[model samples]
Target: MSRVLIIESSARQQDSVSRQLTQRFISQWKAAHPADTITVRDLAVNPVPHLDANLLGGWMKPQEQRNTQELEALARSNQLTDEVLAADVLVLAAPMYNFAIPSTLKAWLDHVLRAGVTFKYTETGPQGLLIGKRAIVLTARGGIYAGSASDHQEPYLRQVMGFIGIHDVTFIHAEGLNMGRDFHDKGLNQAIARLAEVA
Candidate 1:
C-alpha cells in the first residue's frame, strides 16, 4: 500500500485555513484511495528542534567519537528522515508567518534534507537521492502573493523539494485569507476547488 506523509505547520489549532484545507484534502484522498496509509506529523503541536551544533556534530562525527547528546539529536533527526524516505507522497500545510514557511516546518526540512542520505555530491554537481515521490503544498496567505516577487513560500519550497528529487510538486494557495469577507471566501473556495481537482 502507498504511504502518504502529511506535515502540518499551522500554529493555530482552530479556524486555521491551512488546517481546514488539509482536512478536506485528507478526507477526499481517503475516499479516493481507501488502501493508502496516511500519517500526519503536526509540527506546531510537537515541533522539531532547529538544526544546532549538536545535530551538526552528530552528522559529521563518527558514532564512536560522538557524545550522547549528539547521538540522541541524530537519532531524532534520523527518525524524521526515515519517515520521509518511507513515504510515497508528501503533503505540506503551511500558513504564511512572515514571508516564508513556519520555522517549525523549516526545521523539519533541515532534518530530512540530509547529505548522502536524501542527496549526495556528484562528479558534476550535487544530486538528490530520493526519487519517484510527489509533493502537494497547501498554503494560506493573508494577501495575494502568487506569481508575485514577494511570494517567497512557493519558490523556496519548489527549490528545496527539487533539490531533494521531488519534482512532481503542486501548490494550492488560499490567498487573501485575511482580506475582506468577499476576498476571503473567494480565495478559500477557489483553493478548495483546486484541491478537490488535484486530490
Candidate 2:
C-alpha cells in the first residue's frame, strides 16, 4: 500500500485557509486512491524543537562514535527522516508568515534534512538521498503574490523541496486570502477547483 504523509504547519487550527485546502485535497486524493495509507504530522499542534548546538554536533558526529547524549539528540532527526523516507507521497500545508514559511515547518525540515541521511556532499557537489516521492504544497498567502516578481515564498518552498530530492512538487496556492471577504472566498473557491483537478 502507498504511504502518504500530511504535514500541517498552520498555527490557526480551524480557520487556516491552508489547512482547509489541504484537507480538501486529501479527501479527494483518498477518493482517488482508497488503498493509500495516510499519516498526519500537525506541526503547530505538536511542534518539533529547533536544532540547537547539541543537536548540530550530534548530527555531525559519526553514528558509530556518538555518545549517549549525541544519540539522544540524533533520535528526533532519525525519526523525522525515516518518516519522509518511508512515504510515497507528501502533502505540506504551508501558510506564509512574513513572506516565508512558518517556524514550525522549518523546524521539521531541519530535523529531516540531515547531512548523511536526506542529503550529502559528494565529489560532484551536494546530492539528495530521498527519491521517488511526489509532494503537493498547499500554500495560503494573505495578499496577491502569485506571478509577482517579489513573491519569495513559492520559490523558496520549491527550492527547499527540490534540494531534498522531491523534484516532482506541485503547488496549490490560495492567494489573496486577506484582501477582502469577497476576494478571499473567490481565491478559496478557485483553489478548491484546482485541487479537484490535481487531487
Candidate 3:
C-alpha cells in the first residue's frame, strides 16, 4: 500500500483555508485509495525545533561523542526524516505568513533535509537520495500571486522538493483569502475544485 505523509503547517486551528483543503484532499484520497496509509504531522500543534547548535552538533558528531542534549535533538530530526523516507506521497499544507511559509514549517524542513541522508554530494554535483516520490502542496495566500515574483511559497517549495528528489509535484493555491468576499469565495472554490480533481 502507498504511504501518504501530510505535513500540516497552518497556525490557525479554525477557519484555515489550507487545513480545509488538506481535509478535503484526505477524504477524497482515502475514498479513491482505500488501502493507502495516511499519516499527518501537525507542526502548529507540536512544532519541531528550529536548527540550532545542538542539532548541528548532533548531526556532525559521532554517536559516542554526542551529549544528551545533542542526542535528543538528533533523535527528533531522525524521526522526522524517517517519516518522510517511508512515505511515497508527501502533502504539505502551507499558509502564507508575511509572504513566506510559517516558521514552524521551515523548522520541520530543516530537520528533514539532511545532507548524506536525503541528499549527497557527487563527483559532478549534489544528488538527492529519495527517489520515486511525489508531492502535493496546498497553499493559502492573502493576495493573488500565483506565477508572480511575490509568490515565494510555490517556487521555494518547488526548489526544496526538487532538491530532495521529489520532481513530480503539484501546487494548488487558494489565493486572495483576505480579499473581499467575492475573491475569497472564488479562490477557495477554485482550489477545492482543483483538489477534488487532483485527489
Candidate 2's displacement at residue 165, Å, is 1.4
Task: Please give the RMSD of candidate 1 to the true structure.
Answer: 0.6
Candidate 3 residues 1-199, lDDT tens each? Answer: 8999999999999998999999999999999999999999999899998899999999999889999999999999999999999999999999999888999999999999999999998999888888899999999998999999888888999999999889999999999988999999999999999998988
- Stretches of candidate 2 exceeding 4 Å from the true structure: 62-69
Question: Any idea what lDDT model 2 has?
Answer: 0.86
Candidate 1 C-alpha lDDT tens digits along 41-122 = 9998999999999999999999899999899999999999999999999999999889899999999999999999999989
TM-score of 3: 0.99
In candidate 2, which residue pairs clash?
none
Off by over 4 Å in 3: none
TM-score of each: 0.99, 0.93, 0.99
Minimal lDDT window, size 10, model 3? 121-130
